[model samples]
Target: MSTIKLLVTGSTPVTVTTQKVLVARLGDEQSSHLLTFVAGGRSIIVKQTAVRTGTVVVVVSGSPGLIDAELRKAVAKAMVIRSTGR
Candidate 1:
């Protein structure tokens, strides 16, 4: 588990500075994992699973667009880095 400050940009720009971000692999299945974070008094869950075509399926919950685009991007990038062990 690690903490990262993420800037969420939308109609109004806000920054989330905390240590509540959690990243973890969900199962033995490759490419399956989970990401949990806090935003707007809600818990956000981003789950990624391996598809048949060697691609990943990402499902985000909690609030639609509440995490914002920038935060999503940051989370995706971080997930990639974790998966690649970089």
Candidate 2:
């Protein structure tokens, strides 16, 4: 299993940052939202239960090599953009 933390920065609230990432990446988010997504041909679980003032932590858990470079970069970019409001 692997864990990745997405840090939220800039003026945008952490709440908004989380929402943006969910909407952008996790399109099929249910009310429970603990959905499994396929990345690098592997099923990955995305969880964002922790919402802090300056950080939006999105933990991706699954087998080894959880997420690829592209997806990680995309999520990080989303968080950064949401934070900076740019």
Candidate 3:
């Protein structure tokens, strides 16, 4: 299990800790991945898409946060374990 500490900035900045996270590639899209986690009694979903131009775009929905860039980084740092015997 991987733990991520998120620093959410808003009117009052606060830090949120999340341990349960899932990272997976969507279908056969090599440049896209899905990240899901629970925080503040709500589900957070982050879709990361990487382009061939060396640019990455992240779209976050659910449980809105002020620090979107940081949230994206935390989601990207999550450990994804895949079973080869599937």
Tell me how far candidate 1 lies from the true structure as C-alpha RMSD in angstroms: 11.6
Off by over 4 Å in 2: 1-67
Q: Each candidate: what lDDT? A: 0.45, 0.38, 0.40
Task: State the local distance difference test value for candidate 3.
Answer: 0.40
Model 3 vs. true fold: TM: 0.30
What TM value does model 1 have? 0.33
Ranking according to TM-score, highest score first: 1, 3, 2
Tens digit per residue, CA lDDT, model 3, 1-86? 33455546554333333333343342322243345555565765545443221233334443324333344454344322122222
Which candidate, 1 or 2, would have the higher lDDT against the true structure? Answer: 1
The most accurate candidate by TM-score is 1
Q: What number of clashing residue pairs does each candidate have, in the order they appear?
A: 0, 0, 0
TM-score of each model, paired residue for residue: 0.33, 0.24, 0.30
Off by over 4 Å in 1: 10-29, 51-86
Q: What residue pairs are clashing in model 2?
A: none
lDDT at 17 for candidate 2?
A: 13
Residue 43, candidate 3: C-alpha displacement in angstroms = 0.7
Worst 10 residues of 2 by lDDT: 14-23
